[model samples]
Target: MQRALAASILIGAVCSVLSCYLVLKGWSLMGDAISHAVLPGIVLAAVLGLPFAVGAFAAGLACALLIGYLKENSRVKEDTVMGIVFSGMFGLGLVLFTKVETDQHLLHVLFGDMLGITPRDLIEVAIIAGGTLLIVLAKRRDLLLYCFDPQHARAIGLPLGVIHYGLLVLLALTIVASLKAVGIILVVAMLVAPGAIAYLLTDRFERMLVIAACVAIGASFFGTLISFHIDGATGPCIVLLQAFVFVLAFLFAPRRGVFALKRSNSHSAG
Candidate 1:
């Protein structure tokens, strides 16, 4: 239980930070694509006796780079290319899973085994999550400029390529960091929901980051506690809690919620 809480907090922190950028840049699908695309690497890593994270990072980075390349070179839309690449890689991973006999459980890989986390798993999560947090925070302003106005950023002599690929690399690493605790499938919510909730609640980017982190941490902690008591899946419980928060923010947020908008309309009419 201690280890689960620790892992959840770390996951919550790192994922929430990145989630803000993703929400701002409209890269939600990109997170999903990279998460699913890491499956083949995980399976192959097990077969080859390498750390699953190494293989997962490699595959995820490859997927992100490939998507960028195709988006640049082909006539196909970016979203369409992302859909194709992720689905194809996911399919390949599924095939490899069927062909390779490994000890790792498929359900665990897909949904996560948070309660099953070991001391080593906790350490791994700590290092990756810590490193990712530092890098993202350090580069926050540049990344924000790049996401908000790529053309203006380039005109100001920013290295758009570096910022672009750097963010993708960070995104891939984050998904890799989150692989064990939330697994491939549910990590998408970890990457998206908190920032979305924050977005609805605040207009300032800095405040957005803070609110998102708080939301994620709170949800992760309580979700883990709930799951422990109910004997439920940790990842799903965490995600569901984030969803619930989002729904509340959606209906009650001061400036952005449904009721808030309705009130504004009524006042304008008055």
Candidate 2:
């Protein structure tokens, strides 16, 4: 239980930070693609007697790079390319999964078993989350500029390729780190929901980051608690809480929410 709580906190924090960039950049599908694309890597790693993280990271990075390459080299659109690559890889993973004999449970890989997290798993999450947070915080300005305006970022002397690929690498790493806690299917929610909720609440990037982190951490902690009492899956509980929060922010955010907008309009009419 302690390890589960600890893992949730770390995963929540790291995921929320990247979630801001993902929301700003409109890369929700990209997050989904990478998350799904790691399955084959996980399967192969099991067969090869390698760590799941090593295989998952390699596959995720490959997926990102492949999407980029296909989008640039061919006439196919980015979203289409992402759909193709992820679906294909996911299909391949399912096929391989059936053929391979491994101790890993399919449900756990797909949905995560947060309560089953071991001490080693907790340590891995901490290292990945801590390292990812450091790098992202250090390059927040560059990443922000890139997300807001790639052309402007280039005009201002930023290395567009490095920033672009660096963000992808970070995204991949984040997903890899999150696998044991949230699994592939739900990790996208972790990567998206907190930033989206924060986006609705704030106009500033820094504030967005803070709000996102708070939302994620709070959800993770409370969701884990809820799951324990209710005999629920921790990952889904965390994601469900995030979804609930998103709806709240959507309706009640001071500036951007539906109710807030309606209030402003009424005041304007008066």
Candidate 3:
């Protein structure tokens, strides 16, 4: 239980930071795609007796780069490319899962085995999450500029290509680190929800980061507790908790919630 909580917390913290960039840059679909795209890599890694992290990172980065290339070189929109790439990869993973005959439990891979996390898994999560957190925090301001104003960021002598692909690489590495705690499916939620909730509540980027971190940490801790009491899956519980918080933020956030919008509109008319 302790190990699981620690893993989830680390995963949540890193994902929360990236989720801000994802929300600001409108890269939510990219997050979803990379999350789904790693499954086949995990399967193949198992078959080849290799570390899952290597294969997962490679597959995720490949999918992300392919999406970028296609979007740049073709007429199709990025969302369309993302959908196609992720669906194809996920389908391939499903097919490989049936044929590979690994000892790995597919259910755990699809969902997660949070309570089953070992000390070694916790250590990996800590190292990856620690490094990722530091990088994301160190580059937060620049990355925010890149997301909100690419032209301005370029004007200031930022290397657009490096920033773009660096974010993708960081994203892939984070997903690789998170697979064991949240699995492919729930990682998407972890990468999206907290920042979205924070966006609804705050206009400032730095405040958004703090709010997102708080939301993610709260959800992970409470979700783990909820899952333990109810005998439910921890990943789903965490996602559900985040989703619930998002709904609350959507309905009640001071500036942007539905009620606030309605009141503002009425006041303007008056």
C-alpha lDDT score of every prediction, in listed order: 0.94, 0.94, 0.91
- TM-scores of the candidates in the order shown: 0.98, 0.97, 0.98
Model 2 per-residue lDDT tens digits across residues 18-103: 99999999999999999999999999998888988999999999999999999999999999999999999999988988988888
| Clash number by candidate, in order | 0, 0, 0
Per-residue lDDT, model 1, residue 149, is 92
Of 1 and 3, the candidate ranking higher by lDDT: 1
lDDT of 1 by residue, 1-270 (tens): 999999999999999999999999999999999999999999999998899899999999999999999999999999999999999999999999899997866667788988989999899999999999999999999999999999999999999999999999999889988888889999999999999999999999999999999999999999999999999999999999999999999999999999999999999999
Comparing 1 with 2 on TM-score, the higher-scoring candidate is 1
Candidate 1 ranges beyond 4 A from true positions: none
Cα displacement (Å) at residue 34, model 2: 0.2
Q: Write the per-residue lDDT of candidate 3 for residues 29-132, one digit (tens) a residue.
A: 99999999988998998888887888888899999999999999999988999999999999998899898887766667678778988888788778878898
Cα lDDT for residue 253, candidate 2: 94
What is residue 180's positional error in candidate 3, in angstroms?
Answer: 1.1
